[model samples]
Target: MLVSVKELHQQTNLGDVHKEKPKKFDHLILGPAAGEGLPDRLQCQGIKALNKIHFGMSRNNSRSIDPVAFVTVFTIYNSTVESRPVDLVTVGNISYNKVKRSLAILNVFINFIQVNMPQSKVIILTDPASELPLQKDMVTIKPIQGEYSRDKLMLQRIRSYIAFLETRLEKLSQKQEQFTHFIFTDSDIAVIDDLGQIFIDYPNFDLALTFRNNKEQPLNSGFIAVRGTAEGIQRGKAFLQEVLKVYSSKFMKASRMLGDQLALAWVVRSNPNFNVRRFSRREAFLDKIGGASVLFLPCSSYNWTPPEGAGQFHGMPLDVKVVHFKGSRKRLMLESWNFFSSSSDLSDTLCLILKSGRTKYDF
Candidate 1:
C-alpha cells in the first residue's frame, strides 16, 4: 500500500518525530494537497522523516515531485595570485580579498539553499586545502584539489561535474535510489527562490540553460539543470561532452576567460542537430538536439543580475529566482542577502517595485 507524505506526517506527528529516531516507512509518495503543490516547509519536514526511513518511489502518475529527488552541486576553489588571470586582479599588490569574497558569497548561497530548499541534497566540490565546516545530512563536500589556472579552472569544473553525474547515473542504473534532478550552479550566486519549480513546470527536458539579453554572450553557464533519468542523463552528458570539446579546442582561444559561456553558445548555434529558436511570444527557447530537448529560459527570471551602478539594495523582478553575482557584482550579494533575510514579505515588496518595462529598482 502507498502512503502520501501528508498522511504519514499526520499519523507520525512529524513535528516531534524528528526529536528521536524515526521508524522506517516504506512505499511513500508526495501527493499534491488541494490541487496545489505541497508547502515548502511541509515538504522539507517530510523529507527529513523520509530520509531517516526507507521509502520507494510511488508508481502513481502524479505531477507532484518527491521533495528529496533533487541534488544541487557547486564548485569552488581558492585561487592564489600565481594562478589567477592577470586581467582579473587588481593593479596593486594582490591580496586574498577575491578568495575571501568568493567564500562569503558561497556561504550565503549555501545558507539560502538550506533555508529555501532544505529537502534537496547539496554537493560541494572544492579544493582539499580549503576547510569548510559543513556536516549536515543534506550537504556533502568532496575535495577536488589540483593545479589551478585560468584555463584549467573551467576545465576542472566541467570534468568534475561530468564525472560526478556519470557516477550518480551509474548508481541509478544499478537500481540504487538516487536523486532524479541534478542542479549545477556556480558558487558566486544567491538563490532567492526555489529552483525545483523548473523541473516541475518543464518536465522531460534533458538540459535547461539560462540565457541573457546580450547577443554577444547569450547563454549563461552559471546555472544549469540536468534531468537524471537514463535518457536525460545520456543526452545531458552528450551535450556536456560537446561543450568540453569546444572549450578544450583552440577555437575559444580569443576569449579564454569566457571560454565556458562562449563554448556553450558555440555548441548551441554551431551544432546542426540543435534547433535554437525563440518560442512564440514567450521568453523561452526550446531546442531539440540529438533527440534531447533543451530549454533556454530567460535569465531575467531564472538567473537575474542587478544592473550596473545600482545602489547597495535594489528591488528585483517579482519572478526573479536565482541572482547571479557575476564579476565585481559579487560584493553586492551580501547586501542582497541582507535584504532577503530581513524582508518579512519578499513577494509583496517585489510586486510593488515591478513597474511596466522595469525589472529592477533604479535606486
Candidate 2:
C-alpha cells in the first residue's frame, strides 16, 4: 500500500532529479480544490489498504479515513541579518537568511509535503510582512497579528502555536469537524512519508512529542501531534499555557535563549503530575502529564537529523520519515533531498516503518 521513493518518482515522473536550481512551486496544486473533498478512490481505498497491508485493522473495526482528518501546520516569519544576532546569519540556514534563500527552502519543504501527502490540509502561520507564494487552494496561509522581532523568536512561535490550537478548539466547539488530528512542525522539516499512520497506530494519545537520545534535552519540540477531541484540545491548551508561564517566569531568565524548549522540558520533568515511562524495547516513552496522555516517539524515526560529514546518509535508517534540517544541517538536508530524489534504488521505507511487527502500540 505504501509506495517506495523510487516508485513515487516513477509514478509522478519526477524527471531530471539533478537540477541545480530548485523547481518553481507557484502553480503546483497536487490535490483537489479548496472545498472539493478527496478523490473517490482515496476516500474509499486509502485507510482500508493501510489497514490490510500495514496496521492489521480488520474491515469491521477500521474507521473511514478522511483526507481532511489530518492537518499539518507550519510557522515562518521574516527576519533579516541586521535584526538578528551575529551568530544567526548563514547561507544554509533559513532563520536569518535573506528573503530569497529563505523562501527557496520553504518552497522545497512545502513541495516535499505536497508530493508525499497531497491529500492532507496544510496551514501556514506567518507574519503579515512575510511573503509566501503558496496558492490559497493548495494551502491555507494565515497571518498572525504582531510585530516580528529577533529577540522574541521563540515567543513568536509559541504565540502562533497557541493561536493554531485555539482556532482548532473553537471549530471543535462549534461542531465544524474540519479535522481530527493536527501536526505542528517547524518549517525546516522535510516530510518524507505519510504521517496519517501515526494517528491510526497511536489512536488513544492526546499529545505526541518527539525525543532525542540526549538526557539533558530529551525532548525536541519540532514535531508535535495533537488529537482534536474535546479533552485532548483542552489538555493541550493547558499544557502549552503552563509552558508559556514557565518560559516567562523569572527563574528561566538565565537560559531564556533556549526559550520554549527549556520551559517544555521543565514542565514535563519537574511537574509533580507528570509520570514518564520508557519503553523497555524501543526508544519510545509514554508520559502522563496532568491526566493527559503524552506519547514520546523517538527522534530517530520522526525527527531524524543527518550526522556530520559528507555521505553520512549511509547511516540513516530506511524507515526515517520526517527529517529536520536544524541549524547548519539545512545544507545537508538539501543535499540529501537531491540525493534521495535522484537515487533509484531506494525502497518503500514507509511500509517497512509501519508494519505491525516493526512497531508495537501496547501503551
Q: Give the clashing residue pairs of candidate 1, or none.
A: none
Give the residue spans of candidate 1 off by over 4 A: 1-63, 67-99, 145-147, 251-256, 273-282, 308-316, 347-363
lDDT score, candidate 2, position 112: 71
Candidate 2 weakest ten by summed lDDT: 354-363
Q: Candidate 2, after superposition: displacement of residue 298 in Å?
A: 0.4
Q: Which digits, one per residue and each the tens of the lDDT, describe model 2 over residues 28-138? A: 112211111223211112112221112123222324543423233333444433443533433323333445445556666776776666666677787777766667446
My TM-score estimates for the predictions, one after another, are 0.66, 0.66
lDDT of 1 by residue, 1-363 (tens): 335545756877746755675443322223331101222211122212211111112213223664433333343445444445422422112233555545566676777676656667778876566577556667778766553455566666777677777877898889887556888888766565667777777876899988765556778778888887888887888889888888888445643367888888888878575544452122766787655689888776677654421111233433557666665454345544554566644442222122111121111
Q: For candidate 2, report its TM-score.
A: 0.66
TM-score of 1: 0.66
Number of clashing residue pairs in every model? 0, 1
Local distance difference test, candidate 1 = 0.58
